[model samples]
Target: MAAPFSAVPTPFRVRAADRWWYGNCAWDAFGICAALHVDGHIETVCADCREPIVVEVRDERPDDQRLLFHCLVPAARWWADIVFT
Candidate 1:
């Protein structure tokens, strides 16, 4: 596990399309889950995925507002790359 607190901040938001791959299997999901865990906002990320194609995440927690402000921002370019490659 990473240290409880690190000198640098972790990226709270990441695009699904940035990580998405066609024919993605269990391994891919597991890898994504691990990455999300390190991000510290795991529950919100997972919850956003349960919806349709469009997903958004907004910070509801009062204390760590900065850390919680995240959304599954669309990565259209990444998705295009996945399709082309």
Candidate 2:
């Protein structure tokens, strides 16, 4: 008799372009931080900032892929809006 089936694993992996997009988003966020510092929007910037202030807590966890992408996207958009608009 054939063996019983188990839960199937995903056959495919994420594409290179997706990975690149995430990394690019992160870089854009870092750029936004610099822009905020320059543009005298320090208070609003603090509200938008995602970098953890508590050093130990920040260091304890390994990076999360989704959260990292989220952290980058809005911040980059914020800066881009400031510069171009």
Candidate 3:
């Protein structure tokens, strides 16, 4: 697993704890902030429209709702192809 860093490019880019990081997914983006124990800012894009989206994190909680974390892969099968997930 990439943990706070993604193995490949993704829409999830994060700036937290005074550093830049990549996330495996949107959920992992927030997870990065939490793991660092500091506020964060996430820059991403809408999956459907390709529009810019920004997420603010305070106390490790997302402060915006412009984006939703939707996973097509089931939790039980994520390991089958983690990069694709």
Q: Highest lDDT: which candidate? A: 3
Residues 1-85 of candidate 1: C-alpha lDDT, one tens digit per residue: 1322223333222233334322132222223434444221222223445532222322322233343323243445534554232
For candidate 1, the per-residue lDDT at 38 reads 28
The best-first sequence of candidates by TM-score reads 3, 1, 2
Every model's TM-score: 0.18, 0.18, 0.79
Clashing pairs in 2: none
Off by over 4 Å in 1: 1-23, 38-85
User: Could you arrange the candidates by lDDT from highest to lowest?
Assistant: 3, 1, 2
Q: Which candidate gets the maximum TM-score versus the true structure?
A: 3
In candidate 1, position 16 carries an lDDT of 36
Whole-model lDDT, candidate 1?
0.31
lDDT value, residue 16 of candidate 3? 85
Q: In candidate 3, what residue range of length 10 has the lowest lDDT sum?
A: 59-68
lDDT per residue for candidate 2 within 1-85, as digits (tens), equals 0111113222111122112111123233233333333221111112256443211112222134233323433654765664342
> lDDT by residue for model 3 over 6-72, one digit each (tens)?
8777779999878788888888888888888889999998878999988899875679656467789
* Model 3 clashing-pair count: 0
Please state the error at residue 33 of candidate 1 in Å.
0.8
**Cα deviation of 32, candidate 2, in Å:** 0.8
